[model samples]
Each structure stands twice: as C-alpha cells, then as structure tokens.
Target: MVTLKLLLAISTIKQWHTLQIDINNAFLNGDLNEEVYMSLPKGLTVSLSSCADPPLVCKLHKSIYGLKQSSRQWYTTLSDALLSAGFKQSQADYTLFTKGQDDQFIALLVYVDDIIIAGPNLKLLHQLQHSLHARFKLKALGTLKYFLGFEIARSERGLFISQRQYTINLLEDTGYLGSKPAKTPMDPKLKLDNIQGEPLADPSQYRRLIGRLLYLTLSRPDITYSVHTLSQFMSAPRTTHLQAVHHLLRFLKGSPGQGLLYSSTSSLHLRAFSDSDWAACPLTRRSTTGFCVFIGDCLISWRTKKQPTISKSSAEAEYRALAATASELTWLQYILADLHIHSSTPAFIYCDNLSAVHIANNPTFHERTKHIELDCHFIRDKIKAGSIRLIPVRSSLQLADAFTKALSSTSLNSHISKMTVHDIHRPS
Candidate 1:
C-alpha cells in the first residue's frame, strides 16, 4: 500500500494516465518446474481396460490454486515475462517494474494478479497491454477506477482514493449501520492497560475486529493511532478493549466516504515529521514512536508503533523515533530516484525535542548514549551527507503528535486538516 500511494502521488505530479489490468486465472499460467502428481477424484477415474492396475494419479504440468508454491511460481513467470520485455525490476520493490525513459517512461506495479500500468504515453501503455495479453489472458479494467478495494476518482485537480463501500460493509457486518456517530475514535483521557480488566468471552472476535481496523488504516490515517492502541490488546482483549473497537467503528460510521486526495498541484519536495510519547506503554514502560512523511503536501507514509527497547530518557525515545523516520525518508529517496525525480534540496525532518535534534547532530557519545549509538550514527550520517536536515518544531505545531497519543477533538481535527485528510463526499 505504501508503494501504491507513492506511485499514485508521483503519477499525479507527472500528470500521467493510469490503467488497470487483471490477469485471468493468474496462478494457472505458471509452468511447473518440479514433477508433481495429484490423485484423481472419485468421479474422474481412468479406464483400467488398457492395464492390469491403472494408476489413479495425474502429473501436474501447471500451477493450480491449491498448490503451495502457486503464488511464487506465478510471480516467477510474470517476472521473467516482464524482464524479457525490457522492464527493469526495482531493488527497493521487487513487484515494481519500469521501462523507457523521461517522457516516454512506463511503470507497472504488480500485486499478485492485479496490475496498475501508468505512463504519460497512452500508446505505449496500450502496446504493453496488448503484449501482456498475448502472453497471458488479461481483462483490461481500463482507466484505473478501482483496484484492491480502493475506489479511485480522477479530476482536473487530482485523484481521490477511498474505501467507502468497504467501510459501509464493515459497519453493516458489525451491526453499527444505524449507530450514533462518534466525534473522536478514542477518548483523550483514557489510558488502556492490560491488567485492569477481565478477558473477553471470545478473543477471536476482538482479534478479527483489530485485523479489519488495521486494513482500514490504509485509507484512513485519522484512525491510525486509535487502531494502533487497540491492536496491542488483541491477544487477551477485555471488555474495555472491545468497547474501544466499537468506538472506532462508530467514528468510521460518521464519515464512511472520507479518503485521501492526491493533488496535481502539490509539489514534489520531501519532508517528514517525527515525534514520540515517552514511556507511554503502561505494561513495559516503553515509549511509542510516531512519524509521517510527505511528498510535497501529500502525506505518503506514516506509522505508530511501540519501541522494542525501553529508553532511559525522553531524548533517547525521540532520537529513536527520528532514526525510524530517517530510514523511511532514505527509502523514499531511493524510490524517487528510481522514478528519475531527484531532490535538489535536502529533506527537512521536523522533531519536537531539541535534545534529540542535538543528539542527531552531535558527534560526542557518553556512556549513557552508547546503547543508542547505532541510531545516532544513522541519523547523523544522513544529516552530514546533506540528505536530511533535522529541525526542531514547537510541540503545538508537531503534526506527528496526534500519532503518538490520543488528542483532544480540537487538536485531532487541526492535525487532520493539516495532513490534508478530508471527506471527499463533503460539500465543497
């Protein structure tokens, strides 16, 4: 999904036309490499008149749906075909393939059977489509309206991607279609702990809900923090945790049509914001790291995860968060380079902690800082190489603050607005 969004954002910047293709019975196209046999079914038995004891098995020559290696085999076949067609596979993302150069370039992103082909030249895209169809049966979806449950709408302004139908179906499945809407996904004052409440009667239900919510975060960044918080309790969910999930569902009910808008007018510059909630986990006393990356004004990537190691100081936690953000920025830079878009200016990474900013720039390391030396060096290397610049921003203006912790309704809306997260169905 991160790669998909990045492609869409770059395509929007280039004003490229995107097309979709679905391979029919995509798995069956792969030729079997090893000799494999399958037992014949009860009704489909071979005649035994020609032999004393006829074999009740058949040798498989092609990949099938139930085969364990079907996906890998299909991918190998597809990769071979694309490689033969002059497309270079991306090291950053194996599923991505690119050909041509400059204005005549074409990019193809593969997700199992579904593919998205984007380029500025319509003739080249059609030629590629015909070529792919000749190799394997393909159903051209045409003009990239929907793929992988995301509904895409393009206009003169830009592209709008949403999961409106998916959200509605989820609400209906959970019996929350007519439920009252929630102003916020989670209560700002709530502190969820593992030891306080009794386990739910059915842990599987809580796990399933969390799984769906995690997918929902793909298009809804506002619920990311709440979903991350609720996901922690999936193993032994209590009534309180289930209630929190219910709250998130109600929040989704309020605006099921809300989604991301990728604007053509947005610039191509890269910037990111990093923040942390020091010792936020009640169970392990570990801090939570949150960061968001932007390509021009569009938010391309964001994450909220609890740190694996406990930091002794707030600066250590913030520094670790900055390191994570820097890693994502480095990968984004590589992706942009693959697209032939070079960043003339260094990416600006905003941090709320001044000590962390200093730690990234400072070469001196003490005994207390030795544990985080790896992270410090990684961030400093990027800084010294002029790939990124760490700047301290006021906590009030920190866009990643909402990702680290639950925020008040006012503050949450403020940050969402700044992130360009809006309901496309709302009146302009």
Candidate 2:
C-alpha cells in the first residue's frame, strides 16, 4: 500500500499518465518445473478407457489456479519478461519495475495480475502494454481510475482517492446505513480493555468487520487509530467492542467519500511527524507509536501501532516513536531514489516532546535513558548521517497526535483537514 501510494503521488507530481493492465489467465502462464500428476475428470471417457485400460492420470506441465505454487511461478515468469524488456526491478520494492530515466522514465507496479503503469510517455506505455500482451494476454484499462477498491479521481489539482462505494457497502451490510451519525470514530474519553464486557456470542462477525475496516483504512486515515484499537480484540470481541464498531460505522456514514488528495503542486522534499502516547494501553501499559510521512505537502505514508515494549517514561516512548519514524523515512528515501527523485536535504521530523528531542540530539546517556540505549544510537545515527533532523513542535500543532490517541471532534477535524482528507462527493 505504501508503494502504491508513493507511485500515485509521484505520478501526480510528474503529471504523468497512469494506466492499469490485467493479465488474462495470469496463473496459467507459469511453467511448472516439478512433475505432478492429476486424476482425469469424471465425465471424460478416453479411447483407452473404452478398451478397459487401467485408470489413467494426467501429467501437469503448467501452473493451474488451485496449485499452491501458481502465484510464485507466475510472478517469476512475469519478472523474467519485464527484465527482458530492459526494465529494472526495484530492490526497495520487488513489485515495482522501472525503465529508462528522466523524460523517458516508465514505472510498472504489479499486484498479482493487476498492474499500474505510470510515466510521462504514452508511446512507451503503449509499447510496453503491447509487449506484455505478446508475452501474456493483456487487458489495458486506459487512465487508472480504480484499483483494489480504491476509486481515484484525477485532475489538474492532483489525484483524489476514496472508497465511497466500499464504505457504503460496509454500512449497508452492517445495517448501519440509517444509523445515527457520529461526530468521531471513537470517544476521546473512552478507554477500551479486554475485560470490559462479556464475550460476544458470535465473534466471526466482529473479526470480519475488523478485517474490512482494516482494508478501508487504505484511504481513511481518520479511522486508523480506532480500527487499530478495535483490532486487538478480534479473538474475543465483546459487546462493548461491537458497540464501538457501531459508533465507527456511524462515523463512516457521515462522510463515506472522504479520502486523501495527492497534490500536483506539492514539492518533492520529504518531512515527517512522530508522536507517542505513554502508557496509553491500560491493560498492557504499552505506548502507541504514530507517525506520518510527506513528500512536500502530500502525505504518502502513516502508521499507528503499539510499542513492542513498555516504556518507563514519556520521553522513552517519544524517543521510540522517533526511531520508528526514522526507519520509515529511510525506506521512503530509498523508494524516492528508485523513483529517480533525489534530495540532499535531510528530512525534518517533528516531535512535541522536548525531552525526546534532547535525547536524540544529546549522545550522553543517563540512568533514565540507559534502558533505551539502542534506540538512542539508532536515532543519533540517522541524525549524524544527515538522513533526518528532529524538530520540537507544540502538542497542539502535532499532526501525529490524532494517530496515537483518540482526539476530540474539533481536534480530529483540524488534524484530518491538515492531512488533506476531503469529501469530494459532498456539496461544493
């Protein structure tokens, strides 16, 4: 998903033509190396069978849909074809293939059989499409508008991606289409725990709901934290969890078409915001790490996850968040390099915790920071290598705060607006 968003953002910034392609019978294209036998069909009567011959089995020579190795073999076959066409596979992302550079640059991202081809040159894209068609049947969908349930709207301003239909379907299926609307996905004052209520009678519904909500977060970052919080109780979801899910659905009903906008006027430079909520989890006492990465003004990546280890202090939690943010930025830098977008300036990372900032810049470790010594070294290395610069920000101005914890309606709206989330289907 990060790679997909990055590709779209780059294409938007470059004003390139982004097209989609599908491989017909993609799994059947792979050549099987191992010897495998299959039973003959029940209805087929061979000539030998009429002669009272022994029961016969068919030897498989090619990959098939039900085979476990089909997907891998198909990817191998496709990679070989792309490589033969002078396209270099990205080490940062194996699914991404690039050919040429600058004005002649063309990038192809493959998600199983579906593909997205982006570049400024239409002739080259068409040529590549034709080439792929010769190797394997291709269904070229000109001008990418939808892929993997994401509805994209392209314009001079940029690309607007949403899952309006997806959200509506979820609401309709859950019988929440006409439910009372919610001002926010989760209540700011609410603290959910595992032992809050009796176990649900049927947990599969809750699990399925969480799974769908997880995919919905692809375009709706506003619900990410809430979804992340609810996902933890998938195994033994209770009545209270279901109630919370209902609230989240009501929130979705309010603005089903809300999504992110990748702006064309945005710069190519990178910046990020890192934040953490110390001891946010009442049961585990673990902190939640949140971060958002941007290419100029366009947000390409963000994450909301709980820390693996419990932090003794708020500074340690904040520092851990900073380290995680640095790791994501490093990967984004590599991805940018693969996309031929280079930058010498170090990416700026804003943290509202002053102690965390000092801990990152100051190498000297004290008794309070010894437990997180490794985190300190990791953050300092990025700082010394000029990969990222840590900046102090006020708590009110922290964009990542929304991700780390539930926020008030006003605060959530303010943060979501800054993240470029909008409802395009609403009255203008």
Candidate 3:
C-alpha cells in the first residue's frame, strides 16, 4: 500500500500518465513443472476410447486456481517476463518494477494480476502494455479510474483516492444509509470494554463488519482510531460493540467520499508525527501508539496500535511511539530511494511529550528505563545516524493525536484537513 501511494504521489508530481491492466485468468498462465492429477469435473463426458477407458481423471499441465502453489507460480512467471524486459525490481517492494531514468522513467506495480503502470513516456507505457498483452491475456484499463476498490480522481491539481462507493455499500448493507450523521466516528467519552455489554446472539455479523471496516481504513484515516478500538472486541462482540460499529457507519454516511488527496505541488521531503495515549486501553492498561508519515504535504502512512507491553510512564509510552515512527520513516526513506526520490535532509519525527524528546536526545540510560532499553537504543541509533530528528511539538498541534484518542469535532476536522483528507462528495 505504501508503494502504491508513493507511485501516485510521484505521478502527481511529475505529471505522469497512469494506466492499469488486468491479467485474465492470471493463475492459469503459470507453468507447472510437477505432475498433478484431479478427478474429472462433474458433467463433462469424456470420449470413451474403445469403450475400455479406465475411470476418467484429468492431468494438470499448468497451475489451477485451487492449487496451493498457484499464486507463487504465477508470480514467478510474471517476474521472469518483467525482468526479461530490462525492468529492475525494487528491493523495498519486489512488486514494483522500474525502467529508464529521468523523463523517460517508467514504473509498473503489480498486485497479483492487476498492474498499475505510470510514467512520463506515454509511448513506452503503451509499448510495454502491448508487450505484456503478447505474452499474457491483458485487459487495458485506461486512465486508472478504479483499481482494487480505490476510486482515483486525477486533475491538474493532483490525485484524490477514495473508497466512496465501498463505504456507501457497507453503510447500505448495514442499514445505516438513512441513519443520523455523526460529527465524529466515536464519542470522546466512550470507553469500550469486553465485559460491559451482553454477548451478541450472533457474533459473525460483528466480525464481518469489523473486517470490512478494517479495509475501509485504507483511505479513511479518520476512522482508524475508532476502527482499531472496535476491532479488539471481534472475538465475542457485545451489544455495545455492535452499537459502536453502527455509530461509525453513521460517520461514514456523512462523507462517503472523504479520502486522501495527493497534491501535485507537494514537495518530496519526508516528515512524521508520533504520539501515544498512556493507559488508554481500559482492559489491558496498555498505551496506544499513533503515528502518521507524510511525503511533503501528502499523507501516505498512518497507524493506530496498542503497545505490546505496559509502559512504566508516559515518557516510556511516548518514546515507544517515537521508535515506531522512526522505524516507519526509515522504511519510507528506503522506498523513496527505490522510487528515485531522495532527500539529503533527515526526516523529522514530532512528538508532543518533552520527556520522551529529552530521553531520545540524551545518551545516558537510566535503571528505570532498562525494561524499555531496546526501544530507547533503537531511537537513539536512528537519531545519531542522521536518519531522523526528534522534535517536541505542542499537543494541540500533534496530527497523530487523533489516532491515539477520540477527539472533539473541531480538533478532528483541523487534523483532517492538515492530513490532506477531503470530502469533495460530502452530502449536504
């Protein structure tokens, strides 16, 4: 997903043309070197040879959909073909292939059989598509309006990627299309727990709903905190948990088209914000880490997750969040380098906790922090290597604050806009 976002960001910046292709029956194109036999499918009458043919069975020559190795075989075939075409596979993301340099550069990202091709050279893209079509059954999807549930809108300003229809479909399926709109996805005072509500008669529906919402977070970072909160109760969701899910649906109904907008004028420099909520989880008393990464003004990556261990202090929690953000920034730098976008300036990690900032900058380790020594060491190493810089910021201005806790409408709206989230299709 990071690779895809980076591709779109670069395309927006370079004014490149983006195209999509779908390989027909992609798994069927795999060449099988092993022998496999299957019972003849029902209703297919094989011609009897001299009326003495043994009980009929079929021998497979190529990969089939149900085979365990089908996906790997198909990818091997695709990789071989792309590598043969002089395209270099990205070390950061093997699914990405690049060719040429400068204005002639081309990038092709493949997820299974669905491929997104982008480049400044239109002729080269077409020629490559033609070449792919020659080797495999290819369906050229012009202009890349939709791919993998993300509706992409392109203009001179930039690209807007959303799951508007997906969101509406979910709302409709859950009977929330006509529900009252929610100013926020979750109530600021709501504290959910496993034992607070009655066990649902049927928990499968709750599980399924949470699963879909998890996918929705790909574009709707606004609900990421709420979704992450509700997801914890999936095992045996209660009435209260289901109600929270419905509340989230109401929020989605308000702006089904809200999504990330990658601005064309955005710079290529990387920056990030890290935050943590101390003892946020009611049941576990564990801190929650939240972070968002941006390439220039465009937000590309963000996450809301519970800390793996209990934090002894707020500083510990905040430092852990900084370490998590630093790791992500390092990864983004690698990916940016793979995309041929490099910045000599070290990426900045903004934290609202001054104690965490001081600890990160201080070389001396204390006995109280021995349990968290690993995280501390990792963060200091990043800072010393010039890969990241830890800076303290005001809590009110921390963009990742939304990810760690439920916020008032005003605060969420402010962070939403700053994160480049737009609702061009919001209902009146």
Q: How close is every model to the real structure, measured as TM-score? A: 0.94, 0.94, 0.93
Candidate 2 residues lying further than 4 Å off, grouped into runs, are: 30-58, 373-376
Query: Tens digit of lDDT per residue, candidate 1, span 384-422?
Result: 899999988999999999889998889999998898787
User: How many steric clashes does model 2 contain?
Assistant: 0
TM-score of 1: 0.94
lDDT for residue 209 in candidate 3, whole number 0-100:
96
Q: For candidate 2, give the lDDT.
A: 0.90
Give the per-residue Cα lDDT of candidate 3 at 144: 87
lDDT tens readout by residue for model 3, 126-238: 99999998888889988889989999998777999999999989989989999889999999999898888899999999999999999999999899999999999888899
Give lDDT per model, in order.
Answer: 0.89, 0.90, 0.89
As a TM-score, model 2 comes out at 0.94
Model 1 scores worst on lDDT over the 10 consecutive residues at 30-39
The residue-by-residue lDDT of candidate 2 on 147-189, one tens digit each, is 9999999877899999999999999999999988999999998
Two-way TM-score contest, 2 vs 3, winner: 2
- The local lDDT score (0 to 100) that residue 407 gets in candidate 2 is 92
Q: Who wins the lDDT comparison?
A: 2
